[model samples]
Target: MPPTHLRRALAVSATAAALTVPLLGAAPAEPAARVASAAPVVPVVPAVPVVPADVVDDYYADAEGLTGEPLKQALHEIISTDVTTLTYSQVWDALKVTDRDPADPDSVILLYTGLSRDADANGGNVGQWNREHVWPQSHGDFGTSPGPGTDLHHLRPSDVQVNSDRGNKDFDEGGTESPRAPGNYTDADSWEPRDEVKGDIARMALYMAVRWEGGDGFADLEVNDSTGNGSVPYLGRLSTLLDWHAQDPPSAAEEARNATVFEDFQGNRNPFVDHPEWVEEIW
Candidate 1:
């Protein structure tokens, strides 16, 4: 489901944004019911039937010439404003997109152990669940227009501090310096990019940086630069770990847990977690 703020981003009709739902993880089956005790429930549409490979290829081709930030913009434009009547958030909300938590082993069993589900099982939140742009919006990438397909890249829910520390800088294997936001506290050493979720963060960041290469708004953002003050570290450890993760994806167990958590909270599926083949299989 799209955030309230994102819904406003697309002031036109709210049809598409309203359809988001969870993609991976453990969420209650009856989605419409409220969860006051938990994170606010954002309404969204159920998953669109997975498109056939040929259709997917066609869609990918349509998205061709789009990569880095420009590609992301293209995707955002398609979802939020391109359609005129349909907002990006509306589409995402109706679908339910979420990020996964590989830290929890039970996460997989709680949802689905593999791509195949049991008779009684279903996927968790992939929407509404935060697919954080490793490169932040503050730096100005796609302008927060949430939707499915190519737009989905550059997002992955992660620890708030982790996201804050990253702040649109590119993921580098070298150490990093402190953030310009002085109050932002990130103990580069304490920050563990090796953490299960870190891998997800790394891949998403790389994808976004490549997608938004030429967007006028993001040129100033130093995607791969350090703070220069020697406070952050050389390349952020998280950035380096992400490189490794992308080269070698998590194990089946990691995939399951991330998928489960994503399902429960956001309401959608992770193409990376679901189909490892989409990326190089080093891990």
Candidate 2:
């Protein structure tokens, strides 16, 4: 993680760590908040085969025909158990699959910017990239380590500058024009990712809230419509996120990434990406 000083200026909440999710539109600004690639390099990213349908079915069998909060809860219980945890270091390698270029399997794409860079730079610093905690680490006092800190479902490869700009801003509509990344906008309270990853951001946050289940040292992550440098373990503007999820839908990048993660990286699946209908079913 960037040095503690670089972390967004956050007050010691009841929990002491930083509050994640930007809250500029309606909530007050924190007294000073803060804050991929790709190519056909012949299998640039370690290709992860798709998880078998039967395997995925067996994995979510407990929630069959389930819907609403029960389905949500059941899914939480199901996905929360038997997950293979990876170290924060392993995340760097995992991104190669989760964020690969949709157009070219040989390369990985950066989130937000949607720029396709060389896959050879996976670990090399040729093009600067950092692991972006979509849920924002401090929200639950989770640092850059194992467990929630390293979960591949929510972590993504981001341009270093764009990542910093996003900070821990909550998700919402309306913002000053973003100069840093086209299609990106920021205001006093929140940051809007480019259209490309709108559904992506939504799905990741939703997945975390579902997967963590408030157990196993995982913060019971929540999604809401509130804003600000929230100290609680939740993200906001659920209504907007829902809209984004619907408008953008899942793309080839997301499908491939989900399969790769389940088959290779974490041995689990992002239910929302695997089954977008679950968003409405649960919410």
Candidate 3:
């Protein structure tokens, strides 16, 4: 799902339906055995288990009084180091943490469709779910590389058709409600994810921009005011992202996702997801 890759064109009926209002398309279930990720096969945890008081307190404590680009820089220095690297191929396993089914740990939830697929149903199998690059791979031309390619924070399980429907479009206001996924919408050049995940997506983008700061030849991913960042590795619109960060805020689901990523897969937390006010602090 990195920025530059073009999703395969949608089939005619799927396209028309996706471009229409409030489509409640049902996701086909996938077999459980096909999943290859090593994540736990346990049942889903409660939506909001209590987070330990000190688990992430020091993660951003040093940035407490900083603001603007300096704040962004300090936070980046804090989280970007000592990260556990997963191969892009292993994102399947990581999804079990970042995108798991809240009610079923044996499954992963598709972002746009809100459908649960067997965790093994990952990758590009037709009708099966696949890793979606919130920051499209093509724009930065960084495919399957450790930082952008395999970063669990930015990758998510998405319905194949709905992911295809999004097709590298920028996130913005206004568009037809997705026929394939409720709460999601698309139009000429933008995407509107369902309200529940809006803040989740915003925080993910902000996290990517901060975590992969081009220090080690990785793209200095950034969020801007526009879209179609080409080979630039940037996602937009920043103003819209800022608004969504505030408007939707972080839900219990977002908190749980961050906790799982830290306690299980990535080892480093998405600061914004863990602390929403960071968005206001740095931007």
Candidate 4:
């Protein structure tokens, strides 16, 4: 009934509609379905949040224009202000979160071995992970109490045997390679962590030195130049630790861990982690 040109147009329109119908209604190809099913699902880790500039500014407001022991004392006052101390038992749960593997939520990354193990696999067993006091509790004699003993800033998850092997040794440069933790070296007097975490270890030690200044009934912690500092509330070789701090700057994970301690857990930030330049300025 239509004109010839109109009929041709209608036919073309109908052909397009017909072609679209199959594409719209059809299931995906069997090959595609099978390929998708065979593919592994990658887990997603939430990105670490950056600490706001104003927050850092305000936190260190009282510490401005200061250097050397005065700077150290000011920072000590700043970090020690209104801190929330966790019990030693609560630290178990805290490390599981703070040191959680970015690639796997259910696992934690060990400090020395760098192994990612199941979060619940924390204990004294040979294959498990346990709390590593980066600042040895024995050095300060603050064993398992809520203050310096349980501070999360210096606490980390570590392989059980590796933690034991690292036991209270002052950090220094060289030794035989640690048995299970490659890249780490240990001798009778000192233990050097793998290069990657050397700055992390140093900053934690610095933080302890600044945070606990012989007040609050806790021993005054310090970083000196000697090793074999048995139960003296001091950690050393300072010059070596300073080198480690310079050699390996703060990593993103370390910064994020610092933020987590400040924002979520400890209500205080590690000044060395935030302002690494402060290390050279002070020591």
Q: Largest TM-score belongs to which candidate? A: 4
Q: Count the backbone clashes (under 3 Å) in each candidate.
A: 98, 16, 19, 0
For model 2 the local lDDT of residue 174 reads: 80
User: In angstroms, how far off is 114's CA in candidate 2?
Assistant: 0.6
Q: Model 2: residues >4 Å from true position, as ranges?
A: 1-49, 102-107, 119-127
Error of 4 at 130 (Å): 0.6
The order of the candidates by TM-score, greatest first, is: 4, 3, 2, 1
Q: Per-residue lDDT tens digits of candidate 1, residues 1-283?
A: 2223333433423332222222332322323443433322222223432223453344334345544445444443332322222244443332232221222211111111111112122223321122244454544434555322224443433323334555445344434333321212234432333323445555454444333444433332233434321222122333454455566564443343333322222222333444444333221
Q: How would you order the candidates by lDDT, starting with the best?
A: 4, 3, 2, 1
TM-score of each: 0.39, 0.77, 0.80, 0.83
Give the top-scoring candidate (lDDT): 4
Better lDDT candidate (2, 3): 3
Give the 10-residue window scoring lowest on summed lDDT in candidate 1: 108-117
- Candidate 1 lDDT for residue 71: 48
Better of 1 and 2 by TM-score: 2
Model 1 CA deviation exceeding 4 Å by range = 1-49, 60-96, 99-132, 138-152, 158-191, 216-242, 250-283
lDDT of 1: 0.34
- Candidate 2, 1-283: lDDT as tens digits: 0112111212223221111111101111212222312221121222442445677778878888988989998888777666677787767656654565534544556676656555455543435777888888877777876788888778877767778888888898888766546677888768888766788789999998888777776678888887675677878788899999998887644666666565555667788887899899988
The parts of candidate 4 lying over 4 Å away from their true place are: 1-48
